[model samples]
Target: MTGGSTHEIRPLRFGVVAPITTDMPAWRDQLRGLADSGFSTVLMPDVPQWQPAPGPALAVAATITGLRVGTWVYASPVRPAWITAWEAHSLSVLTEGRFEMGIGTGRPGIADQLRELGLPLPPEGQRWSQVRDVVAALRELDGPDRHTPVAMAVRGPKAQALAAELADTVTFVMPQIETRAATVQRVESFDNRRGAELALHVPVVGDSVAAFMAGPDTDPAAVRAADSLAFLPSDPAAAAEEIQRRREEIGFSYFVFGADAAGALAPVVAELAGR
Candidate 1:
């Protein structure tokens, strides 16, 4: 299956995040353009960053015919589980199963953003507690039939364990210290425990990729390590080659790109869409 489709072997799939601007019409066009460019879906990040909120942006995606929308991850620590459940449920319905919800313990700097919003920034335990709670809430509402596919953005042992137990997908958030052998080991660890799909979320920094899109504070050395490329070549042919190599190496078949990388990434999406 490609991009979490029912197919067994992970298919090569590419996706882009929502653009960093809030022009509604332009956002619509950007998503449409990505769909036209062969991207399987468009995912949005949940942060106080330049991107729009996943709900509204996903609503925009609903208007477009072919594109799918997802939250790269909703910051669970700052936001309550029930609220996220409701939003994700509503979005899944509105989009007719064309939505995917990515959940994660809030990223760095999210505490600062939460502080500004007066949202409670709990300790790691409380934050981690909510991840399963939210998933349970969604499942209680719809069961497997209506529950939206959730991709957990996880790095640590606790978070990864939670993902294997509860999430429909586990997107391993490669750390700055990430390496090929380490990635392989992590993947192996998730292999038996997770009942759902496996995905890798990483930054792409290289020629043709804009800095804004390469992932937050991306390390060039990390990108080049052990041929585990969450960040890869920007050239269409070269990018395609890189993807094929990595898929063979560690089976990273699904990819998510940042907004700034869209222009540089569309070609890669087009080149190796189904192969």
Candidate 2:
């Protein structure tokens, strides 16, 4: 279930994770930088403060930047299915059809925030059910009239199956386990029966990056470096080798780099370009 075409040497398609900040100018600048750096896609997740609203910033991002823009995992419980569908459609149209929407159950922190905002919270099981329904609603849109393909970020069996059944792609953040073999098996086990293509979301870290500074409590720097290196090759040829190796091992062909800024993005982009 690969997203788009996987016939190229690098079966993995590269994209950057958008910085979720309220500063619209900074966000647009980051998008421009990513476009200039040769990123083909960008993942804009639903952050509490940096909620995705179809506005001028997104409009400019679509108009000025050539990179494909989409959400990593937009929270489904935050809005009605129709509203989410409408916003996604608008962005897709605004971007001239370079948008994709990834829906998922709200994370714990996001759930808490939504609760504070007085939004109703569904049970965990029902949340996944809603995820499927949301994707179905988006799929109902007419061709060319729809802005983006809908995908889901999932971890468990139930969620993975939902993604497989409804979404065009399935994205996974690197799990706590250390080995690529484990990662591959985990994704395969969850995704084997399902048909959605897999996309692995790997973070790219550098000095002064937010994730680097504020990740889990155990040697933050080392964890940050390790996470960044997961998608990177030890050498130039190694990238292609790793891509093929992971694809054969795990069945995933899409790679998304969740980076901090321009500086952190350059090295990864350069390495992928060499591949």
Candidate 3:
């Protein structure tokens, strides 16, 4: 009960949550910035806060070669399964086969957020059904020449079953598990099989930047300082070693970071991106 899109992901790959920007000039710059800065891919969240829609933004970013683009995890409850299908097909064309459709049962707070948008958040059981519907639709719409990988971000046992059966990449987000053993257990629970990729959407911040930003007059806004977000060690080499050890135990090949922490995390990217 596994899906078929394996050629798209690689071990030790890194991607960043795209920075928000309304103008094309800045958007293009940011897309190129990721490529130049050594991120393997660029991810756009399918949240209301984004300026351009995730599919369209990925399409635009695809104009730059060698940069893979994806929706970090589209909240399936927010739209009909067919609409989700449309996005997958559209992004496949838009990115010329360089897109990954990441889907999830929208998170907790999003229910309140969706209420503001005049959309009700469906229960977990219903959202799980829609997730299956979306997967089936994507498979039906896919042809040999036009295809997009589906990345399922799910945590529960039922949802994990759906992900294992229908996703190309299985993603997990567990920022609260602060220990290596805890992180390893979380990833092991995915039980990723052959022909699938494992992507862990987690925090990554280097030590040097944290130390520098701790100075008395450090501008919080300038550095996007947040102690909770800095999860890795300070030294680039030390971070690389820790990440390598984690990857060995957890089998997570793809790592994603927050948009604001890109500058702080770049040193690790530099240290381990191409290796």
Candidate 4:
């Protein structure tokens, strides 16, 4: 129901990338800024160094604004599925149903940290198995009492198949242009004739449009057309257009916006909202 018919509608939900910083004030300000900018959701990464405990931030965001808050990718191996399940349910209840859980194989760096914590990194195949099992457990928690959907952030072939089988949504963090196209292609391949919804996590660089354009593979023509943003065009709009172009070419619709920093998201949000 949310995405409409698979072919006719473009899934374009805009959200802020989270963990604005370790500074609590900065984090809160980022949330406030995103809410002010008309963003309805935020994606908090589960990087140990940056992710604050979900308690205070989730509570405050619920109290202050109607922003939907959830982790971008909670490391599946770092915590047991039950504990993650409990925390997710608690937040869902606390936020009055604005919580969504994103789970993935913990990052390689995170695996090293797990070693420091005296935990063994499960072998790669086992890790995916664990993610699948964990997702299954979360899905079982989806009765009327706990209705939040679990989204999976997947990269490789195995994980992609698991995502198609288990997740309500599949997400990808696209750091480069080719990766973006590849992500759409992979999703299309998985969904087959039935188009799938994809949530793309994109980084926002600056206050101006030019900052977004400052990245590699920028198109000059896109810079001319993206004047909606006041700051010099960094070419985020161009980047977004490229992504959309790829999606159309590959026959997939649905995207979620994520900014590297909280402030970096303003131009992107403006552009998406047709400002």
TM-scores, one per candidate? 0.86, 0.77, 0.81, 0.74
Candidate 3 residues 25-55, lDDT tens each?
8667767767877898888877676466787
TM-score of 1: 0.86
For residues 66-102, what per-residue lDDT tens digits would candidate 4 score against the true structure?
8888776778778787777777777788888898787
- Candidate lDDT values, in order: 0.72, 0.61, 0.69, 0.59
User: How far out, in Å, is residue 132 in model 3?
Assistant: 1.0
Which clashing pairs does model 1 show? 1-7, 204-231
Whose lDDT is greatest here? Answer: 1
The alpha-carbon deviation from the true structure for residue 201 of candidate 1, after best TM-score superposition, in angstroms, is 2.0
- The backbone clash count of each candidate, in order, is 2, 2, 1, 10
- Positional deviation of 264 in candidate 1, in angstroms? 2.9
The candidate scoring highest on TM-score is: 1
Candidate ranking under lDDT, highest first, comes to: 1, 3, 2, 4
Q: Model 3 has how many clashing residue pairs?
A: 1
- lDDT for 120 in candidate 1 is 82
Off by over 4 Å in 2: 1-10, 20-26, 50-57, 143-147, 192-195, 204-244, 265-275
After superposing all C-alphas onto the true structure, candidate 2 shows an RMSD in angstroms of: 4.4
Candidate with more favorable, higher lDDT: 1 or 3: 1
